[model samples]
Target: MFELAKEFGGIQNPEIVVKLFSLTLMGQVGTSRFAICLKEGKSLYSKISGEYLETDKQTLFKLVSAPLLISELPDTKRYNILHDHLLKEKISALIPLQMQNEVKGVLCLGDKLRGGGYTQSDLEFIFSLSNLAFVSLENARLFNEELEKKKMESELLIAREIQQGLLPRTLPTIDGFEIAAENISSKQVGGDYYDAIPTDNNKFIITIADVSGKGTPASLLMANVQATVHALVPFQLALSIATARINDLIYRNTSSDKFITFFWGSLDAKSKKFQYVNAGHNPPFVMRRDGTIERLSDGGLILGIMKTIVPYQEGSVALNSGDSVILFTDGVSEAMDINGVDYTEERLESFVKGLNGKSASAMLSDIINEIQRYCTAAAQYDDITLIVFKAT
Candidate 1:
């Protein structure tokens, strides 16, 4: 068995070694009552059969370390660990497969079938076999680990592709308004979303939301919200009803950790009336023609926080010529600079009022640029987004 294990171990193909070990074990047990315990003190493998047969690593480790496990083995002092006892008996190659200061496994051959204990020669043979087997096992383990890593990488790439496609590929055009939105996703996916939903003629619904958290779980919840809104919009239901259905759908579909701060509004082309609802979101700021600012904040609870919520009350503001509406995520107000001061709502208001007569696109760009300027050396804390509606 020792010579055969040595030959098989040298072969790069691990399957051949596995088969040899099994075949050897079957032969050993056939006619002898002798025990050929492996160096690791695992059950003896018969040379006649090529199989693992009966070796549990967990159980073997317990046997080697006393007091660590509940073992029924007798406390007889006569029983010695495979290596220590075999060395004392003078085996030629006690395959201290264990390296210097390293615990390579051990192999212990036992006495003859009808006899008392293992002879010196038998022990030497088993020691040789253990050294060879360790190399084979280590190689097999490394191969399996590499295989698993590649599999995970493939799946993650696919998940990222699907996420990108589902998001808005292009911003919708609003006749007299220039709008821009961005979702700088984290390494993990996010449920945070933005959209420019088309409503009646010349009227479009602009929305932005931070859906609780990030990742596959959040992405799934966001998908539900997008699907529900698109399906309900064509019916032209009241904003309150639309919100109500959305809330119910979210609450019923997700866990407690899942919720969304959503903001949506309809922009009337000729009337210049911006009707909006703020469902626990960062309010949209309107820079009035008179240089006064109004934070459009009237709606209901964040969706999915609970099973039922008060109808999202509709809020409206009539935009006079030259006024602009700025809708954003909390990421804006919360944006911090190197000094640790946040770019608060108060600052944003004063900043926009400064650009009173700017074009819609310019205002949007200016606002974003302002954030970057204010944040100076600090990175964005959350997903920063913005949309501008200009009453021309």
Candidate 2:
């Protein structure tokens, strides 16, 4: 027994321990046939020298409480199924591998080669051996699980860094325009993206998008959208035509279930003309100098649903001094309170009406603060993003 314990303790691999345990039991009990069964995840795993019987964990747990001959089980309806199976497989004895009064596995042994039944001492020793092996196997499984968890956490950190790098580091300083944007991920990585790029002829582009889903997959797709937008900027295509091409590219590359709610506009500082496309995104509120608000919603379907069947239509808005455009993802509008009630778009519009003369940065900060106050201690369930640009 001491030698067997020493041997098991020396091995770190569970598979090797199981094999050695089976061989030791066969040699010690003078049997040619043996089987070791262990539970792995939702399935049964068995190692046998000869034929094996397929039995579930529930059946084994209910039948085997201690070491005993298979024939000793009551010949009733309750034990009939397991009894018949053991008999057919030539298994004569059952030893349970238990820890903390719970059965973790079972050891089955065939008849002695000399045709004699196993004594009580032999059964006791087999039970002890089986438990020792089970402890080693469980330890190995737990170690592997911990290692996998650490690996996933490390990968997520890298993904978060990459996702953040794709966002604009500094908002372009367009003359007569004050712009401020912020994104807060609900997890280590998210799908929300925003950017401001300088273009030709005293003009610049402002873009914001919310890709479906979250985590690594969503972040990767967000990166793809950013890349596509940057690559097409030099072409200077019409807003409507450029939007259609982007939709087709996203549809061909991503699955049908994946799509992005996108809003982008080219603002000309000299003309004060904003030509934009709203691809099924939340319509940005164009609050004029007065209290009146206009929603920019004229465009085609969201990107990646299918090839652009209908050409994207452009929407033009003339921004005057003191006018502001507020754009946001649904995360902000659908943010839930502790009572599960959403802070809807109506509340946002009412709040904006009170901030007619505030700077872009102040407006953005105040809106985020209001949302945080409304949500209170409730956990954020999605990414929150906002972009506020004012014509100064």
Candidate 3:
């Protein structure tokens, strides 16, 4: 019996244990056919053929307290009921396979092929063997589950590295300007992206965008946006004309459901003028030196929604010394607290007012710290992309 138990322990497939149980018992105590009925969602699967009956799982719960012998159970008693299931199938022994004091499955053995009843010693031996096999089967299931989880975590880490490589490694040093940007993802690789590309003649193109989805799909789409922007912006094309072409390209290449909220601008140090377009993005706050604020609300529909639905409108602002621009994704304004309340736009506007004369880097750090304090250690649920550009 110990040798048979050891053999069952080495088997990974749970169903194979039932077939082996039938063969091993036939030699010892004349039991022949066997079946394993396991819980499948709300139903019960009684065989290896994948057949299941539409029944409440509570019916199986009744067998957890003890093993049942078909001949010994009184058919007329309400508490000893088998529902005539075993009698109809000619099963002589039913053993509960338990783990953590809960029955995870049942082992059923039919009448002997030679036509004899199962003795008390035969029933006890089968019960012990079923428990041994249950341990092996449960361990195998948990081992596979752990392996799959590790594989997924490794893949997400790789995706995060690739996404980081896509962003600007170092911000371009533009004369008369101080710039800094940060992307703090919410425990996942997300769609928030920011770039500061140096264009011709001491001019710089700055952009911040958010893709429509989460994880790998969002990161891939953000990469596509970066590729498009890099390809078109260097041509010194009109901001509106270049933006329209980007919309058309994205519309043709991707499904209609995918879109990007984008905002990009070109700053010319000589002119100290910023030309920009905002494509259905969160309006950026332009905080002036005098503590007055301006929200950049230019451009048209989000990219990839349709091909040139509305001609993108170009907007410009003349930057004076001490003027600052704050750009961020919805992740900043929509961050949630432990109580599920959002850190809203009104709070953000008030916070920016307090840091009226701070440097770009200091302002960015303060904003992130305030957001963390508001959340009170609640897990961030989205990507926080921030950019601070100030005229020196």
Q: Which one wins on lDDT?
A: 2
lDDT of each: 0.64, 0.85, 0.81
Q: What are the clashing pairs of model 3? A: none
Please provide, for model 1 over 1-392, each residue's C-alpha lDDT reduced to its tens digit, 9 standing for 90 to 100: 65675576566555665555444533642222212334443343432221221332223333432111112334555333433443343322212344343544434233334544444554454444544565665565566668777775565455455556656888777666666666554444556667778877777777777777755666666777777877887888877778888898888878887899998877777687888888999888888777788888899999889865466799999878778788877777788999888899888878888888887778878888898899887866565767776777
Q: Which has the better TM-score: candidate 1, or candidate 2? A: 2
Residue 109 of model 3 has an lDDT of 71
What is candidate 3's lDDT per residue for 1-392, written digit by digit as tens? 67876787787765675467656666777755665555532222333222221231245456444677766565566534354655556667777878788787777677777887777777788788767766776766666678888887786676677678899989988899899899987676678899999888889999999998777778888888999999998699999999999899889998988999999999997788999999999999999999999999899989999999779999999999999999999999999999989999889999999998999999999999999899986989888899999999
Candidate 1 TM-score versus the reference: 0.61
Residue 168 in model 2: shift from native, Å?
1.1
In terms of TM-score, how similar is model 3 to the real structure?
0.86
Which residue ranges in model 3 land beyond 4 Å of their true spot?
Answer: 4-54, 71-93, 108-117
* TM-score per model over all chains: 0.61, 0.84, 0.86
Q: How far out, in Å, is residue 225 in model 3? A: 1.5
Selected candidate, larger lDDT, 1 vs 2: 2
lDDT of 3: 0.81
